[model samples]
Target: MKWLVPSAFMAVLGVTIAHSLVWGALICPFFIFAWVRYRPSMKIIAICVGVCAIFMALTSVALSGHESHLTGEEQRLPLRLAQPFKIKGQTATTTATTVKGESILVKVYLQDEHIPQLIASNSPAWCYWKGELERPSTARNPHSFNYRTYLWNQNTHWIFTLSNADDFTQCQPIQLTIREKLDQIRQQGMNHLKVVFPEKLQPIAKSLLFGDRSDIEGELLESYQQLGVIHLLAISGMHVGLMVGLLWWCLLRIGLTKEKVRIVILVLMPLYAIMTGASPPVVRAVSVVMAVIACTMIVKRITLIQALCLSIIVQLMINPVLLLHVGFQLSYAISLSLVLSAARILSAKSWLESVFIVTVVAQLGALPILLWHFHEVSFMAFVTNLLYIPIFTLFLLPSLFLLYLFSFFLPNVTFLLAGMLEKSVLLLDTFSMFLSTFPFATVVFGKPSHVLSFFYIIALFYMFSRWESRAPFKAIIFLLIVLCFDWFSSRFNPFGSVLFIDVGQGDSILIDLPWGNGTYLIDTGGAVQFGPQENQFSVGKDIVWPVLKARGITAVDAVILTHGDWDHIGGTLDLIDYIEIGEVWISPSSYEKETMEELVMKLQNKFIPVQEKLAPFSWAAGNAYFELLYPHDRDYEGNDDSLVIWAKFGGLTWLFTGDVEEKGEQELLSRYSLKSDVLKVGHHGSHTSTSQEFLTKVSPTYAIISAGVNNRYNHPHPEVTQRITEQGAVMLGTYSHGAIEYRFRGDKGTFQWMIP
Candidate 1:
């Protein structure tokens, strides 16, 4: 037990350094030893064990980061249409998620698929294609998912892609051993359960039984996440505990002794782990249960701390990478903290009081890591959990599992059970959604700094240790209030900023004034698909809305429509549905097009102000003001009618030229003084726009282009690049740089890239 803390720290060190060694790993042990020395009896022993853990962690990380295969072993050849690419002993798992026509992501293995050999391999080498391997995409933007590290944890680095079925001539079935056969059977069982369950309840059942979440809707998933009872959906300690309890109760009804029941549970644990795919949390849960049972049988007595420490040692020995997972960190933190504070919590006078104390303790323990990982904190999570935990864990989960199990023998009864499960799940979802809609349901703080997170964790531990001391409690409270204020200032303080979002082939720009006075949106990107199976992504719903919500933006001061192009105005309706819009400004000739006319009508129906044929005007809104520059007093059509706006703030002038082309640029150059510090390059840097004469006239210090990566049009054409370079302006494109942001205050400004 004395070695537990060092072992846990070492496991974390191993995972953190797996990709590359950091100096912090070497320095962290001294701090751990300093803290451990407080316990006088184990002071020397703790130091010795801590040193040993550090060296072992370093060795483990070195091995983990080593390449899975030599470069020379990789196959390479020019692919041809006529050549037959045969795939043997390969198994395709999961339905493909169609990214676009002929481009789908499915678990198709072009490598060796012999089950035994694949299992024995250290890496997911068996999942790669036979030809040249391409690395997976990594997160380069703020608050984006890190796909590369996620795959790395699963021992998968490269993913296979095919142009279509034409790339493959034939494939052989996978070879499986007895154990592999059982695993396949388990997968089939999950598939069958999905078919038997109702549509809404299917995802929950799959998550509970097999941890499959591909079919879950994004909105529903987000609601569960906000409610903080999302952990109940994952098969972890609570699920394991419920199953064990049920088994014990049945055995007791059959007149079995308590010792015999414990023995049976110990035997069943391994089987259950295999069935659940042995995810980190599942393995941790099973290990903890086994340790407790073993301690009971052998030592005849065991404290919760001893059992927990033993379980941590066992799980880490099996797979040290688990230490890097958020789930592993949170699960262990909550469990250990609960055990440590169990006496205080259990002493509550009422059952409800006990539940509230337990919930608060678990949340307090997990708070630092949660804030660091998620960038948001659920303010009412404890209350939601009190309602969600009993219904989801104690009743709904058990009933669903029993229904799934009994469906095999009495298939006719599944529909009735599924109906009951579906109703309960829907009710829970409604409650979660309603709760999440409340003001300040969750606070998005962005990712906290490492220094800040470390201090918070230290303060939390200090308060727990000195709970009875009034001074320490007051100090911790003061620390929290300070952190909250810091977060508020970071987001809403007086500072002007512009974000050029990556919206594929379309354009969307977010502009904010200093002191939070105005929030303006330039355009909303869109997708266009015809025929059956139309593409269903909305830039407003998926990209723009989340960005707004995360920043606590509920109302937009103005929405400027550049033109009626679907790529420009497609997401506007969706955005309007989600957030309040002040007014929409359109060009004089906008009503000439049916699309623009319909949009105006829709806005009027919603009682939102629409200003068509709006003359060129300038108005002050905050520290800065905006001036409409193009289509002034003239009725133009098509690309020439695109609205051009100029904004001046903090001594820097920004010119936002929509998809305006050569003719429109000439009009602006002749009619007005258009020199600016920053320019949004026209027509996504098309050769037809951003003429040399226009570039020379504007002479912008910085030029920004928004386009998709490897777009069919190959935007930001060479001619446009040359023109911008001739003007001595630094060029930035969303295709290569992701999102580009600039923060302006007074005479100075700073620029950064999402990838950087």
Candidate 2:
């Protein structure tokens, strides 16, 4: 039996064992794959195990060496630029290395617009830089993306933010190495594309030729991602194949012998890889092709699977952490699936059938990875990829390549052609986006548990083994059962949760009912932005929505915007497009102001009710009861008139006072006597709210505050916290605890926090 497959899995299992136990749970498939596919001899199995043990030792040692070199207390450190600065408007980001060669992400406020141009024009690697080093932040919510882990996997542990761009150190001259020269050429090519093509076309050209996807518009990128064709926006296996074929034809046309052409292409491949940013997909494709070529040129016959496995082993040998990369995992997974199923693809009756077979196989390989990371799978991937991959492969990509070349020589003729190409792509993009709007285009399953993933792998392996052995396809039934079980598990869950999200300086709470009865969002948090709207941080899109989707909560029964404060209602509009909302509840108001009028009208257009709740306004959602307890008959003013909600759920009484200040609290006191099991501290525990009298009146068992960490406001003020403490209430602040949750069944509940 062949040894490459076992070797590949063993190497991965080794590194993963060292890096993360949860990730190391992947041992299930590797074991099953070896047992089912090969059933190798005991001696061969022993050899593979030895390889695994050796890699485990090596990975542990490497991990020790991978720790951040800097202590993160340094105020200034001279650094080398590892990549060109990427600047847009007033902010720029790049990767830089410390004197100790530890990479850190560098972000700077480009106060001087010329800074990027200045840095790019010089030997960037020789530039001097001084900045404060800070540790990266981990995810504050469960199932949210962990950026800290991402950086660590890339060997980046810290961040350096330049206070002022005007103080940038002048770059010195240096001899450019081959990689440096190639990068310079790449930068020049991208700059040329940026200048020649219209904005719509520039992203396609820059990404296709150079693997720089920084220019793709976020919405369009999301559309592509929803269609599972986002890989087209970067250099991938297809691009590599296209490039090699195009180069081979050109070299032969120019009178080069076939062997000479192979050698020429071999030499250019590495250069092309470096020039295109050496992303995992590019690196994997280039490595595989180079291995195949070298094998053929040396008259050493090798199967495509062997070449692919050889590339994986070599890449893992160089950097074991490469397996952590989503792109690398995806590349190998899809490639392996195609290779293992080559017979089926070859037996297809027509080209269309072949393409469909390939697409289905690739999607099957990519399914778990996508769901694990994103908590959702595009049901439309098969159709979207089937329809659009050809357009991209045949026309858009080639057109971009030709346009890029033409821009350097016949610069004037590029725009009209680029515009025409842009129009065509835009039309296709619009079509895909329209398809994405269907309610069932994508389905959220959240991330699978270790046990579920294990079974999933086993079932998938069993199914594949049956296909390979040309047996009855009954194994697919087990695969489908596992998938359906994982997908619909959340709906069968019986517990409920009232969670106070960590939305940094804002208030956003999720109240989810047991057994998928209902889901409600109290507030969608927002950040105060002083710059361009496009550049603003999206609390809804980035934070709140992730939390919602990760829990398999697809549609919100109601979105209650307590008041008009940016921190209270700002993210509501952003959430509208991403999640289905039944209605919106705002504080009592005339909706006369231009902003209010526009917002109400927009909600009306979507058929989502925009209602103003007054005192005595009560509603039932699932088994939860909510009653408005403040602003009985007054017109909505400012934060003082914010909605005060009294809710009873999971057999507990709770008060949600949204930014209501001392004045509003007094009115609430005069109008109603309140005692609650939980109190959401008003105005993020500002001094002007949550007064001692109010705390005494409410007499909550627990008081929770939502505020940013080390915020300018310094919320949960000492006096107010002292008051809550004096009232005998357990104090919890999002600032200190990240996200706080009171998970319950009937009346009994347990409190949990993401941080703790």
Candidate 3:
């Protein structure tokens, strides 16, 4: 029993970093710690080590087996539909299996909406599909998700793109397999659930009942995430327990024998697990119950811990890819903590005390993993879980279950209850959103260094031991001290940087002063929306924030918007909502534009200070001195009115021309002297900007351009590049390099490219 944790942990390592000898270090240290703490027998230790080796070998075999055959060329294949088509407007996506039984994702643009309706009527059980297969895209930025690695983890490497939806008409449909039939049933159940619940509650109902979280989007999702109770929204062990209890009660009411009830449950549990999407949590819950039932029949009892360990080993052995999923990691980690502390939990005198212990233990379990990946943790999570867990488990789940049962037979009753449920959920949602508004709900810790993460885990293990010993306060205080140290180190680090971020067809530059001086952004790159959307991507939330937070930057002294262009200022609007901000600067005339309306309102609402900077408005932040040099008390004239800035930092003179064109450049030369070691190219290096004469005047040694990859507006134009080249300046563009960074300590610095 003592060997279980080490064995399971090593299995995870075997799946994750089996190819590297470095991972053995992480394993060996843990083994020594476990030996000192648990004092397990030598034979058990050897067996655990043997188990690790076996899993490592199995993982190597599994991963090496999935090298892609897709050559990014059009090819015809008789493919069987692996999953139902998920249609969204003109486009739809699904999975298919080649005749060789290789899984490939299928993404298609529909000829018409009518195609989905027709396909739904006669679901594509199997089809001889024609498409172009290509490798999935990998992450292009630090801390961004890699869809290619994600697909390969699931033994899928190719994405089949169909030119037209009507192409499905070319193939004949074949009979469905048993598993396919079950999937269809599950899909139908989800649709039924959607129809039964109110529009607002559909996503929640689907998530709880079927583990389908696809529809759970937007601020409501964020609110749950902030509360750290997002896990409560998903199907877990509690849901499984409730379902089983409900089934057992119903069977007993029908006068079924107790033995017969157990048999029925055993037979139906796997079916239920399958129909509910078979998520990691769901599988763990189901496997444990089945294992317990089998053990009872054999007159041998299995401890809850043993059952849990067995499930982990069996699941990982069967599909090592589960190791890569965040959900899998969280589910197992939290569950293991609960089982290990079961004695303490059961010893609590009151239910409330038990709940508190459980919440704290679960938080401890999730902390290291969360910090390692997301770089933040919710401080409000404990409060939210204690308040909401009962509301969800005791009130919501039961009501939903009743509603689900009644929807089939009791229509009039169902309608009235559904309205009540929707209103109840709405009220909870409003409450949750209000809680999210608290500024300190979540604290950014940043991604920890490997050494720090190791120490944190070790400290957590020590804390768990103290909890088991009924002396937990010292460990709690110790943990808080460790957290403070983490924060202290992040703030006072001496390094400073000038980062040219990849904002895609826009501009964003970060100036981080040395030793906790200040941080500022020249622009917060925004997405260029073509039309209205249900949820348009936010560069601040999706791209910029991740990069910043990953680098442990949680506060900005000010965000200086070059112009009112959404591409330049739009991201700041969303960014200020999360990160701490002292002030925002814009061109004097830029604030009058319609595009700036939202930015101004959001900044004002957040009670952050805002100011307009013009020529002669010079300021110093630590050793960094900045001087505004353009748009002197004038009206906005679009790009030419961009707030041009000159600065001295890191032993170098710098110039940031915010989309200022040839005319504006000439004006700058006439009004002021211009020379810099580093230049932020104007208007993403458009030929309209960056005149040859202007480049000669600035005479920068390094000129960095920010632009999108294969953008509709071709930027960093050849003429501008030639001009920079003629000026004897090294030219770099975000489109080519991803991000261009100039890092320094005190007066010394070096330039680095993300791609390089």
Candidate 4:
């Protein structure tokens, strides 16, 4: 048991980073050194090393075939539906459904899948879908969520899309089991709560009771995250603690012995865990609580840390993949910190002081992982937590839980309780929103390297351990120095970069200036679907926001809409809503003006003025400048009238020709010298643009083509490719390389492909 936690933890870590051997190599030396210094018996040392190696091997073997099972020319395979096929998330045009059983996570995108109909008729079914199983999507850009790794960690390695009803090869419904019925009941409970609660309180109820967050508003959730009180939204140890305390008090009053009560609670906790979907954080919390109870029941004098270690070992043994979950790591990390420091912290004079101490310790403990995973820290978290924790724990949590309980067991009382909770939830939400608006509520940092993150953990633990005794000023200084180093590296680096973000068959370019002067964005990518559903997706929210937030970009100095084309300008409104914009510029367009006018009005509402018909001009700042080159005393409809921009910085010149065609290029060449070091290939390299005459005049060292992979329009036309090759210019396409970046300093520049 003593060795179990470390061995299991290391083995899981090994499996997660199976592609890298360096971690295991580094750990081996430490173990060998310890053995030599302590002079442990050779047999004991060998046994310890053998146990670790075996666990690692077992984990690797279990994961090795997961990918292969989905591939290798396997056109047909069997999949048992986990439960009644339920809709997970549905937009107007598409429905996202999960089919999980046999430790697999299969996302089935259904326009009309026969499996759903079959499951509707018969709740349990074994079905074979005819299609190649696709590997889940991996992140192709910085700070983007890795859906592939996430699914893999959840034992889901492949996705199957059902475009039509005929995709189903075979379907056979079997009788349901007790577990399947329980899952059905749980899902039905979730749906019932949504119907029973009011519109404003529905999300809060769903999250608090069932741990489902699909219904929460994006802006409200972001506010909670910024305020660093987002943990209140998750169902974790706090909720478990509340339930256990209530149950213990009730059972003892009923004349139950301590051991009997502990056993009863232990038995009930697992059932509750299952009902809550067995999330890694909840399971770990329940295990830890159970361990503590078992220790007390057996009259064993076990420290909280020992019980926590046991809990970790038990959870890992149940599911090794849980180690990869961020929630699991955070829960265990925070819980262990509290265990280690609880005695000292709780020794504070007042309850308020104790709460303050606890909040600070939790933040310090979670800081390293938060920085590594999120690339930001909420400096105001301690203060927000101090104020919010009591309201959330004492009032909101109990109210929500009681409502959840009464709604299930006594439906009559649900309305009154829900109505009361609704007001409290709204007030709490408003407070979070108000708190989020404060300057520097959260501070963004660069993603730390592993060594630096590890050092941060060590320094923080030492500081907390020594804080109440001697002053730990040195630790504070060390942390500040590290933070300042990262801040300077991110904000004051002399090399500027232009990132051509991959937004699939559309254009979005971000120009990041050196020394934190400002960032300029050209074109926000967009997609429009016209049908009964009329579903719209914005690249600003899905693509641009993640990229910018990851890099700590909070404000834009300028936004240039190349034209009124839907593909280029549709995301403008979303971007304005998600971030702060200084100025909006639109080029001369002979196209319809309704959509553009509406967008302009929205920006104006936010006190942002939109400038139209930006004539040929130059603006300089941050050691660089851009000159508007085209639309000079001429206006034509569509692509020919696209905005043209010329920028010079870091000893290099680049031109952004937004969808300009052959005629526009000719006029451009006739008007001025068109030489540039880098050229954004016109009109996504359509045959209609990048004329041979124009290529000769430009003589660009590199031509960048932005297009979608396997798009209907075969972009970078063969003739254009030949013309560029003839001119001896290298061509890079977003279709192949994902997001392409160019960094420059002095006369030297380097290029990097995000997905290549």
Highest lDDT model number: 3
Q: Is candidate 1 or candidate 3 better by lDDT?
A: 3
Identify the superior model by lDDT, candidate 2 or candidate 3. 3
Question: Looking at candidate 3, what is the lDDT of residue 146?
Answer: 76
Residue 379 in candidate 1, Cα distance off native in Å? 2.5
lDDT of 2: 0.81
Minimum summed lDDT over a 10-residue window in model 3 is located at 527-536
Better of 1 and 4 by TM-score: 4
What number of backbone clashes does candidate 3 have, counting pairs of residues 3 or more apart or in separate chains? 1
What is the full ranking by TM-score, best candidate first? 3, 2, 4, 1
- Indicate the worst ten consecutive residues by lDDT in candidate 1: 95-104
Candidate 3's residue-wise lDDT over 1-756, tens digit each? 555656776676666566555545654686677679878788877887688889989978877887766566657767887467886545678888877788889887666767777566546656766668877876656677678888888888888887555666666667887888898899988988877778888788888888887787678888888889988888889899999998999999999987788889899989999988998999999998887877777787788888888889889999887876788888898988888874754467887776766888898898988888778899898777888889988999898878988999986778778888889888998899999989878888878777777778778887888877878788878888888877766776788988888878788898888888888898999865532264567788777888888877888888999899989987887787778888888888787888887778878888988888778788898888988999786788889899989999898999999899998899999999998988899998899998888888889999999999899888879898888888889998889988888889988999887676
List model 1 lDDT by residue over 1-756, tens digit each. Answer: 556555555545544555335434544644566557665456655564564566457547644663434233334212211111222234343211111211212334534445324322212111223443456676544556677777666555554443233223333233455545556566667769867888888878888887666556666777777777777778888888888888989999999999999899999898788778777778778888887788788865656676776777666666666667898889888888787763644467977777777887788888877776776678788898877787877688788889987888877788777887799778877877888777767766656655666666666666666653435567568568756754765457777778887777888888877777788989877654432232245677767766665455667888888877767777778777567899987777676688778878898899999875443778787678788887865575767778898888867889998899999899898888888999999889999899888888888999999988889899989999888887889999888898788878765779888764
Candidate 2 residue lDDT tens string, 616-684: 888886778888887786576778878888989898999999999999899999888888999999999
Q: What is the TM-score of each candidate against the true structure?
A: 0.84, 0.93, 0.94, 0.88
Question: Which residue runs of candidate 2 sit more than 4 Å off their true CA positions?
Answer: 29-33, 112-122, 125-130, 164-166, 169-171, 466-477, 527-535, 590-594, 617-623, 671-673
Model 1 pairs in collision: none
Off by over 4 Å in 3: 1-6, 19-24, 38-42, 75-78, 110-122, 125-134, 530-533, 725-728
For 524-635, candidate 4 gives per-residue lDDT tens digits of 8765443233233457777887787767676888988888777788778877755679898887653346777778888889999787665578888777878898787545
TM-score of 4: 0.88
| Candidate 1: segments with Cα more than 4 A from true spot | 9-132, 163-169, 177-179, 255-260, 462-476, 494-496, 527-535, 546-556, 573-584, 588-615, 620-625, 634-636
